[model samples]
Target chain A: MVLRRFLPALPPLLAFAGILAIWELLSLYFGLDGLPPPSVALRQVPVILTDPQSLFDIVDSLRRMAIGIVLALVFAIPVGLWMGRSRFAAAFFNPLLSVIYPVPKAALMPIIMLWLGVGDASKILVIFLGVTLPLIYHSYQGSRAVEEKLLWSAAAMGMQPPARLARIVLPAALPEILVGCRTALVLGLITMVTSEMIARQTGIGNLVFQSLEMGIYDTVYAMIVIIGALGFILDVLFERLRGWLVGWAEPAQSIIVGST
Target chain B: MIRFRQKQRSFTFERGFRLERGLALAFAIAASTAGLTAASAQTIPTIRVGWTVPAEDAKYWMMKRPQEFPNLGKKYNVEWVQFQGTAQMVQAMAAGALDCSTQGVLSLAQGAASAGLQTYIVAQHVGEKAPESFSVYWAVKDDSPIKSVKDFKGKTIGLNVLGTGIWGPLAIALKKNGIDPDKDVKLVEAAFPTQEDAIRTGRLDVGVLNQPFAARAEAKGGLRKVFAISEEIPDIVHILEACSKTFVDKNPELAALYVQDLTAGMGKALANRDETLKIVTEIFKAPVAVFDPFYFKTRASSDAPLGSADFARDPGAAANYDGIQKMFKLYYDVGMLPKQLDVKDFKHAKIFAPLKP
Candidate 1:
């Protein structure tokens, strides 16, 4: 059973090794100063992790990302649920959301910075804007698929409208909602990096650009590796949590490897 | 019940569509009339200026010492917008967000040629009239085989930005040394701060270093200066103060007043070295020691006054059209500029007229 359990991990580990091999080969073939080999880049990962300043930047970025995702969850889930249940609410908000959906949240940093200044507020707001959309989208989809019978039964059992929504629709829609949360989690990280890159204040994004500017190729690649690892680890951890929370639900018909 | 629900849904969607269309139309009309409204408002017009680095742009210093420019608040207000690069500033200008900003010749050319951003060069910002003033240094590791510019023929040289202020001079230097800049050597974009480390590690043959970075590299040891930008392009105008043509045409008096205030501010900054240094350090959030040695000081070779003359002088005079034309030609020759640009066409005669001695 232990051997079988560990077998599932082998393919991904092999894929990781294959990717590194390809990267190393490409760097060697190009022989460009800017494109350092995987080994060289990997060596700098520990240096970045050990360095207090870089560590602080990474942690600060995660902290902002966490706050933004939480704010998005608190605000988006309800609105999404409302929109899904009420045709009027959906009609009212659908056009507005559609207009906002295509706008690159990171591109709003300059205007947002003008209004909110360059501190944590602007960065967090950008992350919030980024993470909010997917959560709302996913929650809407999830709640829309919730059984009308379940909501009716809750109401028949003396549950009020709000209670019916909270108890019956929320649980029934949770699997899809969790999927949205996972997507938002990825978007939060992207928005955090992009906003920081534009602002150039401080963060992992700033550190990455700073390294590039200084011609520290290894450090730049190392940052990419670290951020990639963070995304992967977060997705895995969230996947485990999702399994724990919605284990009784039927398996999704199609597993989406990448989230929108 | 289903028929009623369908009717209600259609009604809501129709209302939503109408609302969206109405709001969009209102926004378009408001946007179209915004310029006219501002023109008639008769309030103090705010000149939105974009800046990237605090140390490089004089506008940052001028804004810091507002008391020096008497016309700052009374005649006009300066809204300083921070940008990460000149390309972004160009985009902002194109979007009508910025009225004036410091731009390198390469950016100015690219903006005019490709981006269709018409702007008037009001005054010179920074120049390399050297042996006296600070010049960008291209350095290499002390033990590296690249002894001179000629030795860079086959080696990769790192630049802060690919085709901006420094690239023009480096291209000129390489051409002068009979090295075809395009084919003979490799140029990669690297930040000034990292160039020293890159060179030391043999990752780069030559790394471009600008002020503070050069000084810091020197203090750190292990790197030797291969060439100074001034050697190739003496008296080169590195950066120019450009005001949007639309802004200039609309408010000629304001544009001229802004230039006058700018020149006066530079004069004051030059006169008060101690205070200027303090302000610079405060803006950069660095130690005064990093800047004191070369902030505005002429090289030890010349006996010029300890003032702005070394960095920027005689704002009243027309721009150094000769030097600017040289830069344009160099950029054109380098294939950096899409086409050759004449300096006379871009100069704002009226704005600089008051400042002319």
Candidate 2:
């Protein structure tokens, strides 16, 4: 059984291994005159890690990610729930959202700097704004997807509004809500880097932009690898956390001994 | 009776067809004649000049606002757009998106030379003591033990980039003070706007800042300058207004017009410094008063006719070029450049070439 399960994943693993090999070969073949090879970029990893500033960068990025995710959730879920439940609220907000949702967040950097100065507050707020729209849209959709029958049954039973929301609607909407949270989590991470790119003094985005400007291609790739790894870790951790909290919904299976 | 009706129908069809053909022929001839007249009509030529300095900041040259490349518009058609950095403006010049631009002398020199763009210094914004006017300063936290350029050894010094403007000036200044800027100090790269914040947050031990940013840092009280490029490298040329050789070659008259307009702008800039400050205020959208320290309203007249003497005449040029040669040599030494990029490789036939009136 172990062999069967493990063997089935080998193809994907082999494919990834092939890609890494190709990357290494290409960098070495091309030489470091233009773009540094993977090995050279990797060599800088130890140096990048040993420095306290690099660690501080990681911590700062995570801190921003946390703030952004928290803000997204706080605003998205409540507004999403209300709009999902109330037709009037949806009508009022939909038109405004349709107009604003497509505006790029990078364009807001100059204005944000003018208002907030070049500080952490502006970076965080821009990330929050970028992540919130997608989260709210997704969660709002999820909440609306809740079965009308379930809501109708709860209402017919004379259940209090709070009890109905907590028991019937929220649980039914949990899976979709989690999906929206996942999207927001990823968007928060991306915008955190993007905001730093535009009007920031520190953080991985600023570091990468600085390195590229100075033509230090090695540092750029190294920073990119680190950021990608951080994103992956965040995604995995969120997945595990969501699993633990909402694991009760995991379908249980039963087997009948028809042979016996 | 049927035959008579058929004949009448044929006559009606023939008359109608002839009438339609005549109308179509008349319309086609009239449209072609009208188009021929329109094709020969002359349209006024419009020139767009890109400068990193905001129009308000550049108000002395202003006809009105930052975007309006005045005098040129009044005399000839010209629009000036301002950017926050020389890098962007140079990029525009490289892409043929700009007709002319004003960039830091160092940046414009390197860019023009490399891109094979014929560039000439049209005007100068002169300042007192090159080193004092344009030096990179080392600043440490008020309570920190870092006291001098020598103390910066083994510590990271924040600069915009390596092997560029600040790198060269800082290297010479540091070496003069008895330290190898390259080997002793770690140059940390940061954007111009972020230098103050980096210094304030204690992320950077010292930073090399220019006028507006430097002034902003001084106001915050956390940063105190330990040394400046101006004090060490006095009378340094920071920026020059330039245009491409191709542009000048293609439109010499227009190029001359540009130089005249720039000279006019510089004159206007110095004549009405207070009014210019108001212009800078509107362009940057920052407080109008931010203009007071970054720009020396009166000191700009130090260089006569705006485009005065050759850089060869300036002592700061000795240090500046020596520093650039050293930087180029470092790049060659470290295999950063494929071959030694002599100063000649980066210059054109018209480098500091006079803009004829």
Best by DockQ: 1
Candidate closest to the true structure, highest TM-score: 1
Q: Which stretches of candidate 2 lie over 4 Å from their true place?
A: A1-260, B1-42, B54-60, B63-71, B126-134, B175-183, B297-357
Clashes of 2: 23
Residue B91's C-alpha lDDT in candidate 1?
Answer: 65
- What tens-digit string does per-residue lDDT give for candidate 2 at B156-243? 7888765555455567667777887657877888765566667766778887665555555566566677766555545555555666
Evaluate residue A236 in candidate 2 and report its C-alpha lDDT on the 0 to 100 scale. 92
For model 2, report DockQ.
Answer: 0.01
Q: What proportion of the real contacts between chains A and B does each prediction keep?
A: 0.07, 0.00
Note each model's CA RMSD in angstroms.
12.2, 24.5
Candidate 1 stretches with Cα past 4 Å from truth are: A1-129, A137-149, A154-193, A199-260, B1-43, B54-57, B302-318, B353-357
CAPRI rating of model 2: incorrect
- Lowest lDDT sum, 10 consecutive residues, model 1 chain A, at A250-259
lDDT (CA) per prediction: 0.74, 0.60
Compute the lDDT of residue B42 as modeled in candidate 1: 42
